[model samples]
Target: MANSPQSKKRARQLVRRTTVNKARRSRIRTYLRKVEEAIASGDKNAASAALQAAQPELMRGVTKGVMHKNTAARKMSRLSARVKAIA
Candidate 1:
């Protein structure tokens, strides 16, 4: 119940921001899923390429405030390790 005009405006803005953030989060998840699929296929080359493609997207999520920097770094580390293991 946003009685104040300012509160109503804020609520509207929150809806818009939520939509944008949701899209960003979904995009990042899609990138991560690509890397996971490439890794699961056991093709080192493909996995490496997928990881490379996903790295920037993940970092972009961090920069956009959709995700944390440390979280992105941890994901990159684990994915790269798995990619390396896909020999």
Candidate 2:
């Protein structure tokens, strides 16, 4: 019920932002899933590579406001540790 023109415009902008954010979130999840699958497969080299590839994507999510910086850092830390443990 956006009666005011400004409110209507804001609602439209919100829809657009939501679409973009959803895509960014989905892309970030895909990268994280790749790392997880690589780690689960017990391939050290592949997991390391996947982790390297995912690092920037996760950071991008933080910079884009799709995820919190500390959340991304925590995930990266835990994932890297798990990757390291996969001997």
Candidate 3:
């Protein structure tokens, strides 16, 4: 229960932020899933393209505070390596 006006305002802000963050997270996951599907289909070129497209999205998630910097970096590194190995 938000008794104070400030607390009520904060709760409202939190709800808004949560919705935005959820959308961002879902968008990032969609990008990652595209990359994964491309990889699974054994198409190196498609996988590379998907990875390239996803890289910025993942980085955007980091910048937006949806994900950690190192977490994004590690994901990019592993995905790129997998894409490279597709050949």
Candidate 4:
């Protein structure tokens, strides 16, 4: 029940932000999933390329406030390590 005009405006803004954030989160997940699938397929080269592509998108999520920085860092680190270990 946003009675005040400001509150109503804030609610509207929140809805907009939520939609944008959801899209960004979905995009990030898609990139991560690509890496995961490549890893699962045991294609080291493909996994490395997917991870390379995903790293920036994940970091962008952090920068855009869709995800935590350390969370992104941890994901990138683990994915990179896994990519490296895939021989």
Better of 1 and 3 by lDDT: 3
Q: What is candidate 2's TM-score against the reference?
A: 0.98
lDDT of candidate 4 at residue 48, scale 0 to 100: 90
Clashing pairs in 3: none
State the lDDT of candidate 3 residue by residue for 42-83, as single tens digits: 999999999999999999999999999999999999999999
Q: Write the per-residue lDDT of candidate 2 for residues 43-68, one digit (tens) a residue.
A: 99999999999999999999999999
Q: Which residue runs does candidate 1 get wrong by more than 4 Å?
A: none
Worst 10 residues of 4 by lDDT: 78-87
For residue 15, what is the lDDT in candidate 3?
A: 100
Candidate 3 runs further than 4 Å off = none
What are the clashing pairs of model 2? none
Question: What TM value does model 3 have?
Answer: 0.98
- In candidate 4, position 82 carries an lDDT of 86
Number of residue pairs clashing in candidate 1, backbone atoms closer than 3 angstroms, sequence gap of 3 or more or interchain:
0
| Candidate 1 accuracy as lDDT | 0.93
- lDDT, residue 29, model 3: 96
lDDT of model 3 at position 78 = 94
How well does each candidate superpose onto the true structure, as a TM-score? 0.95, 0.98, 0.98, 0.97
Model 4 spans with C-alpha error above 4 angstroms:
none
